[model samples]
Target: MELQQLFLEAIQNGTMEGFFKLISYFQTQSEPAYCGLASLSMVLNALSIDPGRKWKGPWRWFDESMLDCCEPLEKVKAKGISFGKVVCLAQCAGAKVEAFRSNLSTIDDFRKHVMACTASDDCHLISSYHRGLFKQTGSGHFSPIGGYHAEKDMALILDVARFKYPPHWVPLPLLWEAMNTIDEATGLHRGFVLVSKLHRAPALLYTLSCKHESWVSISKHLMDDLPVLLSSENVKDIKDVLSTLLSNLPPNFAEFIKWVAEVRRQEENGQKLSEEEKGRLAIKVRYLKKFSKLKGKKKA
Candidate 1:
């Protein structure tokens, strides 16, 4: 009853600037919920980091900037994107960032912080939460807070995992509760971070130039096999076929990518694959489907 009252009151008193921003901003994840990656990408995009650079919706490993920032080789398709990586990627994009993990001592403190932060046009906020909210079905995910209703105290979670959840008003208290948990990989409590204005670093620009071509080459290979892999029956088949193809490839190239290239060629030229080969081809296509949305997006 008390929470209900807050919602009614906040509906009348609060203003949601971030929710308004999402109409023009809010790009979905490039692959799964690289929530941290995608949310940071949104903030970076707001800061005009990539400008007009077109990003094909491929895995982060195919993007020089994102791959260089993430640690685990498998985080491209797996979970465990940490707070440190978030800070690093923001810095690389020329945004000064500060990460606050499980540090909000009180609901009012957290609320005040969020309210004040959004007041600024000079920076953007990205937050992480455990899956207790959103109907209790997901794990940790990230998104920008778009609005805050002062009377009701509901914060708009501009979920970047668009396919999974829509932008909704989560109560400030519940959202805070969701954030107060440990990331198994980092042993740090989930919380929010702020990314300030952009100013490109000389070194950051240099790194992109050096690694740009390698990523482009990687993307080409994945795109070829992507459609067929997208058509696979199940994940197990995708994994098994990719491994079989990987074993025969040269050491320098990524194993799954080589498999993907083969799948692409066979499909494009209309050659038939053995049942075993067909399964492998489908794996590439499945993962490719994951990134199709971000192809034209500069930030992901």
Candidate 2:
């Protein structure tokens, strides 16, 4: 198979060997403005679906030397390459944040890093991760761009965040770590925007917490503000949370319906609830004793 085909297939099957071959292929090119960007994105897509794959095989080939050959943003720009592709490539190689930071020693390097992190459609935590990885010189504290330019860029970050993507719908533990990190960095605590970014891990967390109100209460304390930012339209994507909540709530469909009505009312009024809130409400409805009797009444 051609290298491109091999790369595409490797991404589909999550094979480390194919990725290794692709990386080898990537190294041969001296003017890798476009190819490097594409190759990086492919690597990201492959590893994101299976982060564990990085533990061995082709992933190991991506040592410091390989990272060094990547072209700087300006060099890529001067060569007329699309900066977006560069962002995508770094993102794919899982080197986005790190790549930008590694080069942030100069004022120009810092500008590129800021632009990459705040790029629309880029994940904020990824930006945060990169910033955290490469701390500023002679500064014990980290700030998300404290100057005028940084402030301007933050507006762009918030705007990009509002552009919603389909739910990730996968289960991942690392997402939890990301959430905790965001909490510490922003001091915002409990909002759906962060959970939504977790892709599919929110479902898992909701499931575990639903059965234990104590657990639910504790986690909610940490992340309750999520629903406030989510739209009713997006609530449909996280219906699984509602299903779990309904399953565990006290048995009373009427009361459950009432709760749904309340949430629906909030949703209608432009309120957003996190998966936890939706799940909590769903379980309460499912457990309603009225539902059990309704089953018997149908038979009678």
Candidate 3:
């Protein structure tokens, strides 16, 4: 279906709510293999997710260049991104994503997902399908589903490769067939991804670092050892538990001490903090005081 046909359907049925939001952010792929990046950037902008960095001339925006956390831009430029990489990139951008490959999902399920996405402005769907199945000029392609014409059972594809093809509607089942084909590069079927905003927790004054190398041991101790020590009836004094925990602390445990001091400084400066932040600070301060008492006892 061409733009004129899509316009006709939109005017008749009033089902272009998703399309209206997406058109404002629609972009053409900068490189031949940048379909995934372009499609993702459009959906990210449509969903109003802040890129957390400046795009150009002080504008913070999502672009093909900004999506390089999962794979290098150079590699993506050489060979287009796979479905899994697209999901990773979306997650790295802080968007909540759910991906479905045609081989792993039924066409009935895909149609239901398409209906749900096209019927609302809160979420958008990005389709990854082979163009050859649709008798198009390319192999694999990525595009956002702008709308679903239920009466006709066709889906409007906002193709990112605008230079080659205009926005068109294809039968939903045929689209599923296109996606069901295996990609020669990854030996896996293409798929669709549902993109939406990820609601984040309130800002915190202190947080644990999962990226640290010692985090594995630290997390294990917190999850496994701490419970047993707390519940053991033989452990008479809480100070004994603190001493054992302090002895097992990694060398970088001083980082937590620094955070405790920083929180105190912020409080002294009259900076208002969330209750969650205050609670975390109190816990850290109490742990530090216990460690301090244990150290004093050992020294004396």
* Maximum-lDDT candidate: 3
Judge candidate 2 against the unseen true structure and give its global Cα lDDT, from 0 to 1.
0.31
User: Evaluated with TM-score, which candidate comes out highest?
Assistant: 3
Arranged by TM-score, best first: 3, 1, 2
Give a tens-digit lDDT track for model 1, residues 231-265.
55344675776664443222334333333434434
Report the Cα lDDT for residue 7, model 1.
42
Cα lDDT of model 3 by residue, 34-126, tens digit: 999999999999998866555888576899998987788999999989999999999878789999988788999988888888778878999
Better of 1 and 2 by TM-score: 1
lDDT of 1 at 278: 63
Could you tell me how far off, in angstroms, the CA of residue 51 lies in candidate 3 after the best superposition?
1.3
Model 2, 88-141: lDDT tens digits are 334333343343322223334434443333332222222222112123121011
Assess candidate 1 and give its TM-score to the true structure. 0.57
**C-alpha local distance difference test of each model:** 0.62, 0.31, 0.81
Candidate 2, run of 10 with poorest lDDT? 139-148
Angstrom error of the Cα, residue 135, model 2: value is: 13
